[model samples]
Target chain A: MRHTLRETWTGLRRNLTMTIAVIVTMWVSLSLFGAALLANQQVDLVKGKWYDKIEVSVFLCVPNVEGGQCTSGDGATQAQKDNIRKVLEANPQVQEVYYESKHEAYEEYQRVYRDSPVKDVLTESTIQDSFRVKLSDPQQYLGVVEQAKSLPGVQAVLDLHPVLDPLFMWLNALKWGTLGMSVLLLVAAALQIGNTIRMAAFSRRRELGIMRLVGASNAYILTPFLLESLVAGLIGGLLASGTLALGVYFIIIRKAATSITTIMWIGWHQAFLAMAAVLVVSILLSVLPAFAATRRYLKV
Target chain B: MITFDNVTKIYEGQAKPALRGVNVDIDKGEFVFLVGQSGSGKSTFIRLILREYRPTKGIIYVAGKDLSTLHSWKVPALRRQIGTVFQDFRLLPGKTVYENVAFALQVIGRPTREIKKVVPETLDLVGLSGKGKRMPDELSGGEQQRVAVARAFVNRPKILIADEPTGNLDPATSVGIMKLLDRINRTGTTVIMATHDSTIVDQMRRRVIELDAGAVVRDQREGVYGTA
Candidate 1:
C-alpha cells in the first residue's frame, strides 16, 4: 500500500495538470448527481414531515344560488355545507377546519380578479362558501375526503397531494436525470482514467521493458500505474466533497432551508450521505481503471 | 547460465524471420558482445533473453527457466536479475538521477531504509554520487547514461545487457560509458553489450559474436571489430 501511494504521488506530480483535470471532471459530475439525489430525497422528505400539515378544500353547496343542481362544477347547498362541517367535526382524521363564507370567498375572488372582467361577475351573493379541512394524519386523508364528499352540502373534496402532483413529477424527473447523467459520466471518468494510465504506460514503455528484463514482478510494473488511478480518484473525490458541501451550504441550507422552513427540508444529513456515495464511486472508478489498464497493457 | 538452442523467431505474417536458427551460450560472469547492423538479429538475441517474444521453434534457457515454457507474469522476475541499459538512457525524465537508480530497488519493493543506503552506494559506483539530485534533462548525455548504468547495476543483477548504451554519445562519452560497463563486469556481473559501435567493440576486444543478415558469421575471444 505504501509503495502504491508513493508511486501514485510520483505519477501525480509528473502530471499535475492532468491530475487536476481528472479531479474536476469527477467532482463536477458526482456533485451534480449528489445534488440531484439530495433534491429528490428532499422532496420525499417534504412529504414525510409535512404531508400531515396538508389540508383538504371542501367546496360547500351555495344552496342553488345560480339555480343549477349540485354537480362537479356547481355551487353547494346550505344543507351540504352544514352536513360536511358536522361530518368533519365528528371524524377523528380531521384536525381542524376553516370556513370561508360566500362574502369572504367573493371578496377573495374579486381580489384575485380585481383587474379583470371576472371581478364584475364575482359578488357576495354569487360566491360559494368552502371548508378547509386539516388532517391529523396524512394517510387518513382519504377517509375524511370520502366522508366530506358524501355529506349533504359538499360539492368537492380535494386533497393537496394531487394538487402538487405536477410539482412532484418535475422533481422526480430532476432526480432520475441526475442519476442517469452521473452514471454516464462515471463511465466517462473511468475511460479517462484508463486513457491517462495508458499514456503513462506508453511513455514509460522503455523503462517498463527494462524492469521486466530485470525480473521485476508484474505487480512491480503495475504499482505506478495503479497508484496514478487512485490518486486521480482521491483528488476527484476531494473536489466532489468540497463542491457538494458548497452546493448544500449555499443553495440547500441557506436558500432551500429558509424557503422550506414553512414546508419540509431534507437538511444536511442526506447531503453528507450523498457526498459519501460520491467518494466511494470516485475510489472505485479510480481503482478499476488502473487495475484493468495495467492488466491489459502491461504483461509483466 | 544461458543457452539459445536452435531458436527461431518469426513475427506473425512476416516475410523474414527476426531471428533464425540461432544458438549461443555464455557462462556466468563472462562479458560478451553481439555486434550487428540494424535488422541483423543482435536485438533479437536481447529480446529473446527478455522474453518479449518466444521462439517459434527450439528453446532458450536462462537460469534454467525455459523461455518457451515461462508464463508471462514470471518474465519480469526473470528480467530483474538480468539488468538492461538502453541507447536512449531511459531515465525517467521527471525523476532525479537518485530516483532513477533507486527505481530498480523500488521495482522489487525493497524497504525504504535499504533503498536509502543502496541508492547512494550504487550512484557512487557509477561515478554519479554527487550528481544524484540532477534530473535526466539537467545531466549531460554521458551523465544520463551513467545514471542508467547505476539503475541497471543497483540491484547487483547477475547479468547486465547494455544495448547500445553509448549509441547516442560522442567517442569520448562512449569510451567513458564503455569503461563503466567494464568496471561492473570486473565485479563479476556478466555483461552482454549489443552494439553497432566498431570503435569500442574493437577497443574492448572481449569475446565478440558478429551477426550478418540475421546470422552469426563470427564468434571470437580476444576479438577485433570487423569491417562489415
Candidate 2:
C-alpha cells in the first residue's frame, strides 16, 4: 500500500500537466452538470409555486356586456350564478370553487392598485363577479375552460395558464438545454480522462513491465493509476461543489430572494442534491475510464 | 524445478514456430545456461517460464505445477514463485536501489517490517550493501544489473530466470554478474539464464542447453561454449 501510494504520487507529479488538464476538464463538466441540476430544481420550484396559484377565472356577466350572457336585463341573476357554480362543483377535475362578488373584485383591485394611478378610477359597479375554479391538476385547465366558455351568464372563461405557460415553457427549455450541454461535456470529460490515463500508462510502461515481472497482479498494477484519477476527480468534485455554492449564494439566495419575495426559490437542499450529483458524476467519469485504460495495458 | 515437454510456440501472424518439440528439465538448485544466436528462441524460452507467453503446443511445469492448466487469475501466484531479470536491467529509474528491491516484496503484500529486513539482506547478497540509496542512473552498468538481481532474489523465489542478464555490460561486468548468479544458485535457488555470452558459459562449466532454429541442439553437463 505504501508503495502504491508513493508510486501514485510520483506518477502524478511526473505527469503534472496532463493531470491538471484532467482536473480542469472534470471541474468544468461537473460544474455544468451542477448547473443543469440547479436549473431542473428551479423549474420544479417555479412549477410548484405557480401551479398552486393558477386558477380558472369564470367571469360572470357585467352590466354592459353584449351577447345575452344574462337572462335578466343588465347582469347575471342569482339563479344563473347558482347554476354555473353547480356545474363546476360537479366536475371531477375541479378541486375547489370560490365565488367573488363584484364588491370583492373591486376590493382586490383597490388593494392591488393602491399605489397605482388607476386606483381612483376602479369601483364596485364597474367590476365583474367571478368564480375562481381550482383544478386538481393545473395542467387540465383547458377542460374546465371549455366546459364553462358557453355557459349562461358567463362573460368569459379566463385561464391564467396562457399568461404563465410561455414563461414555464421557456424555463423548461432552458433546463433541457443545460441538460443537453452537460451530457456533451460529460462525454468530453470521459474521453479526456481516458486519454490522460492512457498517456500515464504509456509513459510508465517500463515501470509496469517491471511490476509485471515482479509478479504484481493486474489489480496491483492498476491501483496507482486508479488512485491518480480518483484524486483528480475528487478535487474536481470539490471545486464544482464550491462553484455551485457560489452560484446559489450570489444568484438565488442573495439576488432572487431579495428581489422576488413572493415566489419560493430552491433552497440549500437542492444545492446539496446538485453537489451530490456532481460527486457521483465526477467519480463515474474518472474511475470508469481509468479502469478501462489500465485494463488494456495490464493485459498479459 | 522446471520442465518443458514438447513445447511448441507459434506467435501470431508468423509462419515459423519459435520453438518446436522442445524437451528439457532442471531439478531444484541446478544452474543451466541457455545459449543461442539471435532468433534462436532463447527469449521465447525465458518468456514461457515466466508465463509471459503461452506455448501453442504441449505444457510447461514449474515447481511441479502445470502452467498450461493454471487459472488466469492464479498466474500471478505462479509468477510469484519465479523471478525474472531482463537484458535491460529493468529497474525503476525514479526509485533507489533499495526501493527497487523492496518493490518486489511490496507487490506481493509483504509487511513493511518484512520488507525492511529482507530488502537489505538481498541487497547485501547481490553485493550492493552500501549503495542501496543510489538510483539506477547514478550507478554503473554492473551496479544497475546487481540491483535488478537483488530485486529478483529479494522475494526468495524458487526459480530465477535471467534473459541475457549481462547483454549490455562489458566483459568484466558480465563476469561479475555471472558470479552473482552463480552465488544465487549456490543458495538452492534454480537459475536458468538465456544468453549468447559463450565466454561466461565456457567459464561457468555448468549444464548448457543450446537451441538452434527452435530446437535444442545440445544438452550437456559441464559443457564448453562450442560443439564439445
Model 2's A-chain: what TM-score? 0.68
lDDT winner among the candidates? 2
State the local distance difference test value for candidate 2.
Answer: 0.85
In order, the Cα lDDT scores of the candidates are 0.79, 0.85
Candidate 1 residues A1-300, lDDT tens each? 677677668788877777777887788788777878787776766554324455787776554443223564456655656776787888988888788877877766654343333458656876777788788886677888777767665666678786666767888888888888888888888888877887778877877775665567877668778777787787788788888888878987689767755545555677788888888888888898779888878766
Residue B214 accuracy (lDDT) in model 1? 67
Model 2 steric clash pairs: none
User: What is the Cα-based lDDT of residue A287 in candidate 2?
Assistant: 93
Determine the TM-score of chain B of model 2: 0.98
